[model samples]
Target: MMKSILFFLIFSVSAALSAQTLTLTEQQINQHLTTQLGRDFPINLGSWLKAGVRLADIQVALGRQEADKARVSGRAVVILEQGGVRRDWDISGDFSARPRFNSEEGALYLDEFELLGYRLNNQDASGQANFIMPLLLQSLAEYLAQNPVYRLDEQDPLQRQLKESVLGLSISPGQLTLQGLE
Candidate 1:
């Protein structure tokens, strides 16, 4: 018994030591997704925008959409910058679907952004409060992979991970408009 306990203790310590930890709040995760994606997007929408993307608006829309099928109410300005000049590329309206199950209670949902018209690469929505992170991450990852800043064959580490993560998701293609920005 003593040997078994000792073995378990040592195994637990070694496992803990070998683990890499990342603790991120919802806001932080969203912000990271935005920044990482913004760095590699085909267009400099945020830089062109007068105020860039608002975290609060995205969060609220995501939360509301996840919780209930409320009208998505947020706008993203896509700014175009060339030769030191800046212009709006377009405005974006976010959309999400009201979860059938009580996602907020304990259900898990995945790729739940029906408003964008494309399904997330991951189609599992089985838990409450479970779909938003993957949706945001996958969206950013998809954008980055599809749009390369310098047209390089290889992307940055974060971009690669994001892209790989996207492949694992259950996403369907969605469309965004750039006409309104100009």
Candidate 2:
């Protein structure tokens, strides 16, 4: 009886630990990005995820490279959730030029612009998308490092809400988008 009880206790603890663990894959990340946009302005997801790609680069890749005399502008909103908590970030701006259209380009190329808006929602649900928040938070962390001061405080309202997050990117393309941070 004692042995059985001990085994059950250990098993329970292990199970609890496993339940709290979250692993995010490239596919999941892409889904998170998609859900965040959810029929909003189209985003060249492939180019947006590339490493070393900044939001500005995304603007260019989206074919917004320069502010030509003739250009198109658009806006998009992204929502992210972690541990069941959700936060929203908005992106709005204009693209200057469209690059040479290529059959292989798909939906990933545009450049030139600006993002204006603020974070919304301090909490969300613990859905499958909840696990991807860590990646978003980490990306936001890197972004904050570059520009230490913004209109908001160091513990920006958003930062306080994300205090208990633990997540990482299991896979990523060559670029990452700081959407509005740029």
Candidate 3:
């Protein structure tokens, strides 16, 4: 019994000392997501806007978007206003990006923007969502071209260390795993 206890103690201590893994809970991940994606997407329609579309206040607000396999998915609302009139469009899609060569940041983009519905002149615009979606996506793409969001911590040693040593980051439904990170 004494020998067994000693062996267990040693094993526990050794295991604790050698451990170099960082695990984040779902709540923590959700909080980070909320904070990161909650920011308003400030964008300019550029040439996509017609003459009356000039000075368009185009903004997209993203809700909690889950990140998995280096890809993010979630819901978003696009708002456009001009001449005391406004339009609100809702969409759920995935945001993807490819990391630059040896760069910490990636060029983020909206891979799929599926408009769920919209409101035009304060009326249900669900019927027109299908038709307007293409235009909205076109303008959205233009804005995204200028502004791309990234989730990278180049200056953060912990994150950088994990990313450098880890083989890959796999995000699942409610868990994130770092493969062979340490």
Model 3 lDDT per residue over 24-143, tens place: 444554454454354455445454432112212232333324443233345556675545556675565443422111223422233344434333433475664666555665555454
Model 2, span 1-182: residue lDDT tens: 99999999998787556532222222332333343223322222243332221231111122133222113232334554335654454433433322221112111122221223223233443443244333443343333233211111125433222223322212123222211110
Error of 1 at 182 (Å): 53
Q: lDDT per residue, candidate 1, 1-182, as tens digits? A: 99999999998787656533222233432343354333323423244322232222233223332333323333343333445755442233445533221112211122233445322222432332143333343453234234221211134443323322221111112211011000
Full candidate order by TM-score, most accurate first? 3, 1, 2
Best by TM-score: 3
Residue 170, candidate 1: how far off, in angstroms? 17
RMSD of 2: 22.3
- Scanning candidate 2 in windows of ten residues, the lowest lDDT window is 173-182
- The TM-score of predicted model 2 comes to 0.23
- Decide which is better by TM-score, 1 or 2: 1
Q: Rate the local accuracy (lDDT) of all candidates.
A: 0.32, 0.30, 0.45
- The runs of at least 3 residues in candidate 2 whose Cα sits more than 4 Å from the true structure, single-residue gaps closed, are 1-70, 103-182
Candidate 3: Cα lDDT at 135: 67
Q: Model 3 reaches what TM-score against the true structure?
A: 0.44
